[model samples]
Target: MMPRLDSNTDPFRRPNTNHINSIYKQNLSKFQNFSEELTKRYDELTPTKKILVWILAVFNVIAVVLILIFHSYIIKSLVKLSDKWADLKFGHLLLFTLVFMVGFPPLLGFSPLSLLCGMVYGFPYGWPLLASAMFTGSFASFLVFRYLLHKQAVRLIQANEKFRAFSDILKEDQSLLILILIRLCPLPYSLSNGALAAIPELSAWTYALASLITSPKLLIHVYVGWKLKSLGDETKTFATKVVDFVSILITGAASALTTWLIYSRMQRKLEIYHSSRQQTNGDYDAMIFGNFDDNDLSSNNNVELDSNDFDADNFVIGDEDDDEEEVELDEVRAETDQADVTKSTSPTNSP
Candidate 1:
């Protein structure tokens, strides 16, 4: 009104600032209510879940402490169990075999324990027992791993690129050979078996074959332990030292050989891959040159045609006959005369 302003142009004609402020305040209140609801939901954990979490945390702590404090006790207990099992005669041998077969895998790494079994039980008893136990344990572990922890095991195997490659090798026909070599060598058996369980390509027969071949060392250990019971203390100690030394040497040599073979195979594969890459590059180069030549020729032809500026119809039109109509009329007249002569001469056409 002060300056005769139009009603639509007046700033004060718009909605009041207070109304917008009220709406924002309402929205903020709603958001706060929603956030409070979410917080309440988060606080409402189940009692069982809470208890389980606490229990697992406590057990993990205790396990760590026991491992640190009683490491020697754990080792001695395992050795004692092995000795006690070996002392049992035939009927008890079967029971001991079952127990040891189930128990020894986690305690002794595969090859050393297999050798221990052989040493304690002798060749005949140790061989069959260790082999059977190993095969059974491997099969059980495989089933457990494949069914229960397959995804986790596979992730671990794939995390290491080399292990993934080796896993692929194990899936092939030479799987048994690779397994035996790995077992005979210084590679970790329990870990390998666990990883092997995750591979879909590994078969029971391949696992069994590898176990049978690699188990002789374990049987030797059981045999040694059994024989040690009858020998004098000094002789037993000496024999133990000798067996340990021999095992170390054999394992070291086998490991070295396996490493060399793996390296050689990798080298050969790399060479083949390099050759293939070079051939591919050569073909690519040839294609590029051929394309370049064709393009050049096409460009030259296009340039020549563009320079002439010639119309395609001009040359063909110059050769056309102007008497084409007269020629067609004469040909039609001759054809009519011939048709009339033929009609008079022929019998069937005259009627």
Candidate 2:
């Protein structure tokens, strides 16, 4: 049975009518404004950008599905295959490494391959193997793109404002730190390689060093794969199982957090670069004078402007007074011309 509330000591007091109405109206207005803004932003995306966003979303969805649902089966199959071809494992690894080095399709991610290395060999072996493969692949792609498709890649990169801004950062002799930051970003390995290839000023040593610096990120993926191999053990203790699950979750979370932080830092740097460039290039005097040399201006018919001609009230853009000022200027000019004509037409008294 529910307790009844006393008239004088009611806990569930009714809200004020005016307050409730105001709150409801405020919330409704906020929702409508948010919906309108979201729709506007959606409409602003270019078709190509929209396609790329959709592709990235699909890729993320697929990755999440693979990790959550099919991981056990996938791990079992890969392990069985690795055991069956234990003798040929190293050779297959070499072949995959070579293919990665070629980087034919830049969208092909490297994480899956790194995980495979861990599944075949333990994390200790996997980390070194994946690191070597990444460094070799990066260097090879760098050389290939540098020699073969340099012009094409540069043109493509220059078309994107963000990439152009990043490239400008690379040109500042801070390539090593910038490249390391880029490597730490959540971008796919092949994509990063392609962008790095477009930087004409980036040295081979700096690229290799940056690759080495970010190689540790592969450890988390390799560890996840290694733990996955033990997940299917039927004889494992309950505590052991719990520990393994927790470790995997922690490692994955840490990797994601670190990657997000690095990516955010890169984005912030790019934003700062863009803002500084705008401030530098946005000066009214500089913009007006940039295309015209003083000599060129002297060669043309020059019109001098008086300070009094630029009244503050007359310069108010889009105001009624602006139009009135224009009419007044025309009348004044006509009066001056008429007075000059009359003076010239009148006979001189001295003559």
Which of the numbered candidates is closest to the native, going by highest TM-score? 2
- Model 2: lDDT to the true structure: 0.73
TM-score of each: 0.42, 0.62
The top-ranked prediction according to lDDT is: 2
Report the C-alpha lDDT of model 2 over 11-50, residue by residue, as the tens digit: 6777678988997997698689879987787789999988
Residues 246-342 of candidate 1: C-alpha lDDT, one tens digit per residue: 6656755765676667655554554565577689898888754433456767675642223244455544323237578778889999999999998
Query: Candidate 1 — which residues are off by over 4 angstroms?
Result: 1-84, 88-112, 170-185, 217-232, 235-351
Model 2 poorest 10 in a row by lDDT: 98-107
What TM-score does candidate 2 get on C-alpha atoms? 0.62
